[model samples]
Target: MYDHTKQYRCTIIRGKSKKEMDDFLPVYAKVIDEICPCSESEFESLFNNAFIRFLPESDRIKKTMDNHRTEIAGKLFGMYYRADDGIVYESERTQKFLEDNDQPAFFKDICYKMQFPNGTQKVGTTVRQRVADGICIRPIAFVLKVLLIAKQANVFITKREIGYYILNSLDVLQGNASPYEVFEQIVKDQKDGTERTIIVPGKATSYNWQHIKEQLNYLELANLIRFTDDKRVVLNLNELQTIELFAADYDKKPEFDVYSYDLSSLDGRKVFQLDWDYYFSQISAVSDQFATSAEALLFDGTVKDEQKSEGKPKPAVNLTAFGDEGESIVYEYEKKRVSEFNTRLANKVLSLGRTKGIGYDIQSVIAEPGDMAEFVKYIEVKSTKRLTCPDMNDDLWVDTLNVTRNEWIAAQQHGKFYSIFRVYFTRDGIFMFVIANVAEKLNDGRMTAVPMTYRVDFNKSSVDSVIVPQS
Candidate 1:
């Protein structure tokens, strides 16, 4: 419900405004004066260096500045003239100058502004000011606040715990109503399009807890946090401080204090119970979206298997009857399917099961029409039995399906040419899902890559198939 587009517009306008320059220039000048008195050109050089250091390494600030020098100069002049002369600003002259010359630096747009219910706007002094003031609607900042709370508590927290904490404390932190009272007002504003007011004690609308849980997933994808073996959310201590600083939009050390909590005394179960039924009801509304057998297998409680309870008898064919041999059936099926898809390249499809070091289970070729060329494709097939119950020991439900180090390395090396075939055996039939270029997805955080195996030191040649220690 947060208006991100409006927030972005506010940021850009604030960054490009005269007020921002006026606020920044004096502080910059004082810093330079403390070091050594310098000419305007020297001051500009020093300030530019200092500013660039605060920005992400990937930014194109220098190139943008060089390409738009004339427009930037004109805009600066217009701002300064209007402020010093105490006259109404003339936009036509500046617009004409900007149109005739190159545009201002692209980096100038990164700022923040806040709009109140009244027809008034508050401009941010810096690009990060909006984020620091908690006016920005970015999930990263909210997630960082969760981590900060966890850090202060010195304990790993769960997603449910974080959501409850935010629901209870965010309004209080912002100097609004108490946690119980705030959502009622928020819901009223959302429903009637009228400004919210103090409400008489009555039934309140339910809050969306899943939205907060999804934010935790975003943080995990960013590598700022990791799920422990016990499924608790653990902050990556090494990245925590750096992430906090970046989230706060701090150019150097933060000027403001981050919120902390005494979570040790807080009962997460009690807090979570207040809206548990409502949260599950919200989840149930979206249950139909996950129709795949794999999703059903992963979350047995929420995602019901379509094959079952439809009066369809279970298939007599047991996919996992022969263990690794059953997976061979899937590999054969994949090869046949690929061959059928491209009859011309069928002869080029080679089963790599006998080859141990190749990593992939199959290698196939796709014929390119109008050219005497063939594209090589590597496929890794993984077959699993129908999971009727959830695995209690695994942090992630999908961890039951394991990939060796060699297979992962091969996927990384082949990238686009590589694919993972996950075959799920259901009561109806074997359902196959293709994850093409899985390595690329994993690297980009689109897919999660959780480590599963641990190595033990051993001399392979020194031991026989069955090792018997001397008694």
Candidate 2:
């Protein structure tokens, strides 16, 4: 999705304020559901009137009964599945947004393509036009990743540094290219060879260094970042406590090397459906970790979350972080449970996630209060971050889980001693469900397993090697 050789510029889509969007998008979707196959003008009229009803009794609103169809679609066109015949339809993302009704999910979709090389807005085009392209590189994700990395290294980064070099180049944004290293090169181009405001123009790299910063200003709604007195960009840890959520250790690996696809020919909804399902799967508000509070999301310049999730605060995150966190959460849970019975067994609770070929993540033992330990149990942790907490709400929910070939084999070999701890991350907290004796369950028709992925091999021995004279 990222071209290392190409340079990309940031695009801004400030078609509406945060609250306007929070109010309008859902209403737009509702109108569509209420009347499908509606004309563009019809949608515009209904959506405008419906949304206007939600506003307060203000003179400004009363004075100007605006037609915001163009403005609304400018920023959020990617969420629409419209027809060339001027009709609109319900999209998968629209359904997901309605399914998980909130400002965070709404803004989450927005942020996924808020930055450069985005689909919702044009990139490197004459018309850096809002709602023009069909590509979503998520430079914000890359930018966030860079900031998180620099934070760990105690590196103070300025907005210009991020905008000029990092966001401008796909190499730094999507490849292993370092922002500091690229900045160092930029310094070489400078007459001062360091930070300065010396005038230098006519060169391709010397003008408009703060282009992306304009778009960065729009991220105030998310409220995930702050600027220092020196204009350095920093995570808003002091106010939001979002530092832990963006921890560098959470997702240690980089996602630079991913399969590439072009959807410029497709519509916004189709592009979003594919990207939402695959590209931004774990990175968006769909994951509890990535989700911000309602206040941060729907920021009117000031607000914080009133209702925080209870229990150990394990925020849903990327897949790697999700697994690591799930294992740790289960490990702690096991330790605490065992400590109630036998402190010694609790101390012995082991995290085997790093241990190779274990086919499991954690290890514990079944025991009674009086050190009545029965046998050791191998735990395989399967984790997923969802829109809702089935445990918290007592709602019956089940998702198809992919079990590795090694894990299935371990479940079979370990018999009754094996347990699968299913951990689900919601905005509330992580909920775990234990399924013990998986082999027996599968044998007795209680459960079934299917092959998800496999490695294919040819029987070379059967097809004997040709022994021909050397050419």
Candidate 3:
């Protein structure tokens, strides 16, 4: 797991130790000798091609090279050719990859630190502090690009097709050359000035298709697109309109650059940077929180019949005056019962049943794993007397349930800390069903959302329902 708290402490140093240099320099020299075998004076050109070819065609590598191309290119130039300049560079993405892959650590234990002729210390260059700072590709930006591509083609695109389109387009914009042509140039540029030519080991590819599929799934989670059963995707027209408006406002900003590559270029207009923060803010406002599953309320036994004692006289009450009051009492009773259940688990529960506009019905704090900290849990309790009875003939039979807009919105905001508690009043006892992080489950397609009220739609999907049985 990526520790957000410890990210700042873990950094790369500029210079390499003697042992590191000894180990890495030979590998670098071997690659260069095979590729270019240039004289020491032309080592810079030889080293650049070697280093560029060394990068794997992975998503992380693509992101790193995209953001730090100049820095990376400069470091190679100084490392092999201009020894007087020294070499020091650090980036979080690269450092993390090296650590994970057990590659040589960067910016640690320097054997010798270089100094400039002016007596200035030549420390290593730290790329932008946060990954977000150097982020050129964002999920929303990809979403916009995918939508534009679909619009241009006037057809639904498969995830694979979208991946190919993005990969090809990115190669042109970033590399300023075709994939194969770039690969050929790298090999050709590294000629040894002899009859012999270096043989490139692998085929050149722009991007990995799997990574693009993952990106598509993220867009689906953000509700930017919808997927068909056949894995084809259609742009969410509503989301596209909102994004277009966002693009329009972004274009009016003073900081907007016309020369940048952006999705706006699809319409032959001047490009402008998309406002990531603003786009997310809009998504947050409309997205709803999670809801409970219908299967959680299922019970085995049939509804119990009310039996009257023999020869016992029944007292009748006025249905007109006390009817509303009686219903209110039942409603409060169910809420109190659910609250007590949560309280028994050692969680501090606060009832917001009477508190208007709070969205959730209860607020509680529960200890996280390893007892590191406490997290506030927002719960929207839904009570019903109905039970999901299984039909012997049809396997698809299920109980239908409704979740209001306010409740759903709360789930979206709280995310992991949000849950839906279904308290079912049965003839024998009350049954409790807990569905945590309902919005995330919905986003993952474990649950589906419909208009008016969020529906579990058990008939359409399998439910991983967990029930807390009455003791």
TM-score of 2: 0.42
TM-score of candidate 1 on Cα atoms, chains taken together: 0.28
lDDT for each residue of candidate 3 in 393-448, tens digit (9 for 90 to 100)? 53222222456677778889889888876554322345556778998988997666
lDDT of 2: 0.52
lDDT of each: 0.39, 0.52, 0.36
Which residue pairs in candidate 2 have backbone atoms (N, alpha carbon, C) closer than 3 angstroms, thus clashing? 289-316
Best by TM-score: 2
Q: How does each model score on TM-score?
A: 0.28, 0.42, 0.26
lDDT of 1 by residue, 357-430 (tens): 77788787644454533778788877643322222353322312457788888999998888887665432345
Off by over 4 Å in 2: 1-9, 17-37, 49-67, 71-77, 83-86, 92-101, 113-118, 121-137, 169-176, 183-193, 196-211, 236-289, 293-471
Error of 3 at 157 (Å): 2.0
User: So what's the TM-score on candidate 3?
Assistant: 0.26
Model 3: how far residue 404 lies from native, Å: 21
* TM-score preference between candidates 1 and 2, better one: 2
Error of 3 at 42 (Å): 46
